[model samples]
Target: MTRRVPARDVVVFTRLFATMIGAGLPLVQSLNILGRQTEHRGFRRVIRGMVRDVESGETLSGAMGRHRRVFSELSVSMVAAGEAAGALDTILGRLADFLEQHGALARKVRAALIYPAMIFAVTVPAVAILLVFVIPTFESMFASAGVPLPAPTRLVIAASAVVQGYWWALLGAVPLPALAVRRALGTSRGRLFMDRLMLSVPILGGLLRRAAVSRFTRTLGTLVASGVSILQGLEVTARTAGNRVIHDAVMSSRAAIERGETIARPLEESGVFTPMVVRMVEVGEQTGALDEMLTRVADFYEQEVDTALEALIAMVEPAMIVVLGVVVGGMIVAMYLPIFEMITAV
Candidate 1:
């Protein structure tokens, strides 16, 4: 009965669930109806189980805690707070809004990646096929014609030879490093190193950094606004932090808060956050509106992510086309150079 629950489905469920609660429907009745109405069979089962748990005298948060994969820690905490404050519907409504925004950011990042990935997929096998199969035919024909191959032609022939001779090695070259990286990323130290490396890369690095900031700020803001304690919110935020560097920065800020220090100080010292963010955070703290400030920062950073991603994609598309043209078109021209010379001599 285990299957992945989609974020969009969860968003819809949260919105509908809030509506039900606001209408004063019984908790069990709402859960049962939502479970039946859900299109995703797996998520439907998850909701049904929650309904059963509620019927069996377990609290809503406790049931949600059991399905941690479906319900995020932030969601559980907010739900628990809502129950305590007798405001479950209002909290659920806010949680739905937060989720929708988060999902939009994630979708934007994922969409930005698609074009580059499609280009890579097409470029690799196309180039490999030319080198391993097509180039050698031209090389053999040129050899029989007794023409001295130019440097570019010679280079292409040598590349084709290597590809044809060591195709097995070249095949292993692709998957072995991928496997090794996967193995490495499974460890904390390796993941931290990789995250640090990712944040250092050009163009895309800025997008990643901005996206990370948006995620952290939005999650923390939602939790805080939902009446979750700052420390607990930070703890949950750290777990959602896909990048280890950002995770450490957040945890450091949490420690600073525990030590009677300002949240912005440790964050600024860590150099992960910009000066503007630090100043805004400081003002938020002074004004006792940190949640609102964080939400504003998250919104701004999310916009930055969108702009950066668009600029990167615009650059990347033309760059990839030029690269493919150079590699494939260069080979075709090199093979035809001797024909041009032969035609001239005749």
Candidate 2:
């Protein structure tokens, strides 16, 4: 049966789960309560499934692992470790905190894009009206007045005629090119190349890299703290890391770690991670505080991502304004130039 999922209700579940565990409720009882309290049909169904699993003698981790999409590997691993150690409550609290922080980061990115998207939405319609209707009206007036038109006005009128007459051609061409690009990007080699290219982009690259680092460190740290073995934690971290480029490097490190090599060496050899990150990881290994160090790294990268996102938004606002001005203003100036020339001649 298809179940409805509600975004807001997921946050509610997290909070409720944290509260129940904190209050020392039995796991099965807590799951039953949560399942009953949820209003969303889809979430309620998932919770009910978990409750059945728990009641059937399966651990919470096993129940959650069955729904990998809903419960992240980090979350499931931490819960499993906690269950083993009789510390389910503490692990649940940490998972709630992680999800909340991640949700906040997502919100910030969405907020940053909203202004630019709004501007583009407005500007496209404005330009469309001017090209399709307003410019044509002005052209007719210039024609009926029997005034000799300048070359710029004549050019704009001719261009607008094409746009007005064959607008479907413009729209028809858009998706095919995008589809071809998407197909190309689906291949491993193409994806790898594109990811590398993405990292080389100026402002955007830095923000993306910082975000990748934050995810890597956070997932790794959480796994280590949950008592997972280093190789297994790296394997999970690599799979869970959002960026494929970073994940590939992590996979290499996992292999090396399994073979008794230090994690930092393989990562450094991959040449994707910064020297600062590498050094910190090495120090963490030396001091036997790898989990704590990874957490600090995650925290540092989170701040970096926050700053980078803010700076990107600040820069993009003015940059988009200049771009729109150049495009729209240039078109207007081009269209008016012929009229000014004719006026001067008269």
Candidate 3:
């Protein structure tokens, strides 16, 4: 099923609209052109609405603000900043880059998780079918021999019997835990707990943390560079932080900033940020180039995230294959062991 204005569509729209505006087309004209030429039904409607709003003398930011789902608060605020500074084209281009970069990072992480999930999804039913059906056909022949079955054969037979008897219970079990977890995740406390749990996992947790840090820094840096305040940037960052733990940390940082603490101080205290990130923010605050420094931190963390994810994918791919092999191959071998023994005796 098609989504309601997928992110890739927004990225393409931002880049193309930025190009049109950079070429000196009027805002309304650019929107009109994009609205007509766009293929996505939902986004095209959004663009048409924007064009009408702009025609009614609403500012571009104000026009975009009406479509918050399609245009993030970060984008809306950046557009406002660009409008104030008379640099709409530049801000749009920068926003496009941020969207594209963040999207790419997200896709990498998503692919890493999805690969293993897909393997399990396909393999589980196949194994279940073998146990419930194919294995039983060999059971009677093995029993009629009145010979002691090997341990592996016994184990397989037992499992096959359990599945045949308790298949409904096993099926009901899978969704019960999933629904409970989904319910838990719908709560604020549960979300925080789960997010924290995810961030504490070994290699995967570190990769997730780095990705979150990269997203936080890059988003705030882009906003600051486009002339948004740290307070405002933090608010936007918190709202868009995806993870509840990071969101709370950012909100706490905002509260600290309100109390005259340096931006880095509260973040450092949050225990989520690494010392390197804290130091970079400190230096940026001291040097009055906080935006540039944040950009640098984001750049470093982004590269780190990419490298870590690549390594993770490399490790996980073969590991998943091995798991699949062990589950299916090992079961088949186990079931055939008694036959192999009988043939050897003959």
The best candidate by TM-score is: 1
**Model 3 per-residue lDDT at 4:** 66
Worst ten in a row by lDDT for model 1: 265-274
**Candidate 1 local lDDT, 1-346, one digit each (tens):** 4588999999999999999999999999999999989999999889989998999999999999999889988899999988988999999999999999989878887887898899889988998989988898988888898998889889989999998899899888989889988998999999988988898898767788888888998989888888889999898999888889989999999999999988998788877788988898899999999999999999899889889988988998899889989988998998889889889889
Off by over 4 Å in 1: none
Model 3 weakest lDDT span, ten residues long: 1-10
Clash-forming residue pairs, model 1 = none
What does the lDDT read for residue 317 in candidate 3? 89
Clashes of 3: 0
TM-score of 2: 0.92
Model 2 lDDT-worst window of ten: 1-10
The reply for model 3, stretches above 4 Å from the true place, is 1-3, 344-346
lDDT value, residue 113 of candidate 1:
80
